[model samples]
Target chain A: MNYRDPQLCELLAGQYVLGTLSARARRRFEGLLPGRPDLRRQVAAWEHRLPEVLGQAPAEEPPAAVWNSLNRRLFAEAATTPASAPRGLFERLGFWRGWAFTSSLLASVFALALLLGRETEIPGYVTTLASMKTRTPMWVVSASPEMDRLYVRALLPMDVPHENGCLLWIKPEGSDQYYLLGSIPEHDGADKMLKIDRKMRPMLKGELYVTVEPVAKGMPEKPAVAPSFAGNWVPIKI
Target chain B: MSSTPEVLGDLLARCALADRAAFEKLYRLSSPQLFGIVLRIVRDRDIAADVLQETYVKIWHRAGDFRADLATPITWMGSIARNQAIDTLRRAEHRITQADDVDEMYDLADDSEGPQDAAARERDAAALHRCLEELQGAQRTAVRLAWFRGMTHEELAEHLDTPLGTVKSWLRRGLLRLKTCLEGA
Candidate 1:
């Protein structure tokens, strides 16, 4: 579509404001709007003309809880979130500083066995999977000493559409390769345990990743979508 | 309505500076209409409340991006509420199932307009209403359903029991006519 064409621009802008454009087309239009003042003006004109349609709907006061929740979200909680766990991953990383904060309280706890001489029954490795940008923790990945079983627990709300499951991946420290660990269950927020073969266990040592993939695809050779969350796994000395 | 655009714009500007008092004032002034807009589409109070909360959070963070010359404060805020509701609707396993009950849920015939509507009716809204009346009956219905229900072309076709192509044409022609009429008004 030639957005520079005045007729097309007006029609697209009208459809965009009317909410009749397809999701992909709407996103494309939005991406184009920032650079095109003519398109921006068209969208603004459409928005200006449409609010009355909104006014036709009679107004009803929301419950007091709505305002309370907003206040808590914008003030009470945001103030305390950074103090407790460093609210955003971008701040910690510094390179990607302006990304939106998606998750919260990303605490990576390492419980190493006190005595290396004794055979420890606890999990051999554990790491919290978090977004690199938001630093908000989403899932906890833990592996048994024998590397036979992996446990994943969702800590935040995840939108997994039907027929799609979260697939876990691992990239060793110096290697560029991403090995598929397996698919974790969707957002039941329940602890999901996946049986892992001996071969895939050692590959889980470095960075952990969780990506949304089609269930039919099984484990792809590489991630089909960008990893939703990522974290580094560090060994704790006893 | 007691809060004029200038006041709301000032409050939004203050909110951009992270003033809590300004945020609260903006919420108190703007949320009712925003909530109404969201609730009309989502049709569930809990979901509407959640979307409204998210909308206000965005407003708080992105308040600085708002340009008063481009859109009214309410329109800018209301667009966020509507977009959030649309996102929720798209992401839900079962899309909001209240298409049949939108009129009842919104009380479309309730003539007790709020002060904001009265104030709006004095200006652009009045022109819009007059222009909307000029659309053909089907065109009017098509535009209203798309606006109020957040129905995409496919969903609108399903809801209206009309063919997809026909619905698309209705929307395109209706919106084009609306644009021309609104511009003239």
Candidate 2:
């Protein structure tokens, strides 16, 4: 198709923005959008012109959860930790390795408790981590009630290089601060347990986020890259 | 709608810097109108909420790419919401099976105010309403149905009880007139 033809582009762009183009045609137009600035301009023109139609719709307030969710996602880290600090205990490999061994043992006990339906005293919380973009669950993150330890199990294999690893972050409730909990091993499908610092335990009641960063340099105080997966650490009900 | 172009542009610039407060301000200033637009197209409250969420996420990430010279922030964001709604509608199994279904597709622009009052409120909106009024009645209906219903040419022809070729002609002529009128405005 002569997508560059001004007449055709205008026609298609109008229909595209108006939502009248067929699904197949719409995809074709969108595929053309990235490379063609003129096509994009045409689409924008149509968009600017159409809102009078939209302005006619009666406005309704969105439910409060929308703001709460957005607030939790964007500001949780700013409330607890200075954005540039690197003092988190999770940045140390030796501490992480020791905790990994202990966390595995704890996870086994926790699993056994679940299987036997027996009561346990380790107040714990668990959440399924999912991609922000796709909303597909990728991992499960669990924390002991005392908020001193975390267990992360991979539900899907991730692609992390030997020199690179995944880091977990916690954002305490009612605060904008984000704390670096520590790094997970580079193994794609392996489960790793982490020890949360005693000082940071009180801040673990908020949300959990995981990001892939260079392990050789140590985990940064803040995620240098976008989080790979994230979820809230809801308390476990007996 | 109370936010001026300058306010929205400033908020968008701050959002590009990962300013959480600015993002919240932008959402509060713009979301009700954008949500209304999405609800109009998707016609499902839950789906509209999801689409609105995704739309804001995109707005947050793409804030740096926004150019004030190209379009107003609301226009750019509204386009994102509308396109997402159209995609969601297309993916679902529900399809308009009868001509009567098209009538329920959109609520007409509230006509409580006369044209003069509307024009005085917002120049751009007034200009658009005026230009749209210039088209022949059939052309206007065809264009509105095509837009508000997201109908294909065949679907539009079926809904309007007109020949496929005639519907195409009306839409083509209507769009050309709209482009000329909007640009001239």
Candidate 3:
């Protein structure tokens, strides 16, 4: 049916005023009202008639932030409209300003690297952890004999996904057996310390080795995952 | 006689003439009220802001065509704001299914008024206000549910759990009574 029909126009107008018209119909009505005074009058009449309802409804105060932003936009439009008027939003540098985009990207990359890297340091003992591939120092290890404890820290460059925990491995120099110490605190960019005793007596001169393994939660405690952190523990002779 | 709509009609004409001051004044006066109306319909502050901006842009562009013989300036702008908001709602896939039944609840529908009502309406704001007060409970409900809630006739029917025809009649009759009340006053 043609929206031109008087009845249809009025019905649509009323619904438009009432807001019951579907979005499509409402848009059509707006387009029609400009060209058709009859339709516009019909809508205005409904609006005037409903003053009681609108009046009864409490007025809501909009946020000051909106007003502030609107003022800024209007001022900018007033000031630069001659020069900036031709430029759309993307063309303006202000739209791209600030740290929002770069900050989030940097955060995600850092997390991914920290979670994936495997390496460890044991301070105060002659410990060395090997790279999973080369058995080379993933981290430089140094320890004082007086400390009576081992600290393993990973210094890998890329982020690691650590929704799963990490594993720490230790084997005294000249020993082939790898003893599991425990897991590193996940995703924390701090020195991860592991306890040790001289009774394990594993460290000869520069004999202790520590390796990092990334492990999933609830995995059996028997073995480690990929070796992330490894370094030779060098003793500080006093 | 100058009414609020007539005053706004004049402002819109000035706005059409590229009167930046008039446009600014119009924006200051109308945006908050329109924002509130749009916010109620869209229920999201961000989306409502987007619709509000579009509505004002249309008003600024089309202010010249505004006629006292047609709609009050506020009502015309309201139409733009409401239509944009509803369009947004539709694009978001928020439309209702067939379970709606607006028929049985609003049986007393009518739509007799036309453009001629404008002159008479301008003369009697008080009478219109009174007649609105006199609208039956269902009529008031039907109109409010339609206008503010942005529900369709079928949606209103489903919402009120009434038949489609009745809801339509309630809206029609309610609007007619409201028009008569406004015109008589």
Q: Which candidate comes out best when scored by TM-score?
A: 1
TM-score of each: 0.59, 0.55, 0.47
TM-score of chain A of each: 0.48, 0.52, 0.35
What DockQ does predicted model 1 obtain? 0.21
Candidate 2, residues B90-119, lDDT tens digits: the string is 788345454544334444543343212345
- What lDDT score is found at residue A67 in candidate 1? 84
Q: Which stretches of candidate 2 lie over 4 Å from their true place?
A: A53-56, A70-238, B94-127
* Backbone clashes under 3 angstroms, per model: 2, 10, 57
Fnat: each model in turn:
0.54, 0.45, 0.29
The positional error of residue A42 in candidate 3, measured at the CA in angstroms, is 2.9
Model 3 chain A worst lDDT window (10 residues) = A92-101
TM-score between candidate 2 and the true structure: 0.55
Query: What is the lDDT for B84 in model 2?
Result: 73
Give residue A145's lDDT in candidate 3 (0 to 100). 53
Worst 10 residues of 1 chain B by lDDT: B109-118
**Please, what are the lDDT tens digits per residue for candidate 1 over residues A1-238?**
6778888899898888878887788877877865687888888888777765434445678989988767766677766764123223232322222132222222322322222225445566666665533345677666666767776777777788877888888777567788887787556466777887778766656666778878774557898776666655533323
Residue A212 Cα positional deviation in candidate 2, in Å, after optimal superposition: 39
lDDT of each: 0.70, 0.68, 0.55
Per-residue error (Å), model 1, residue A235: 38
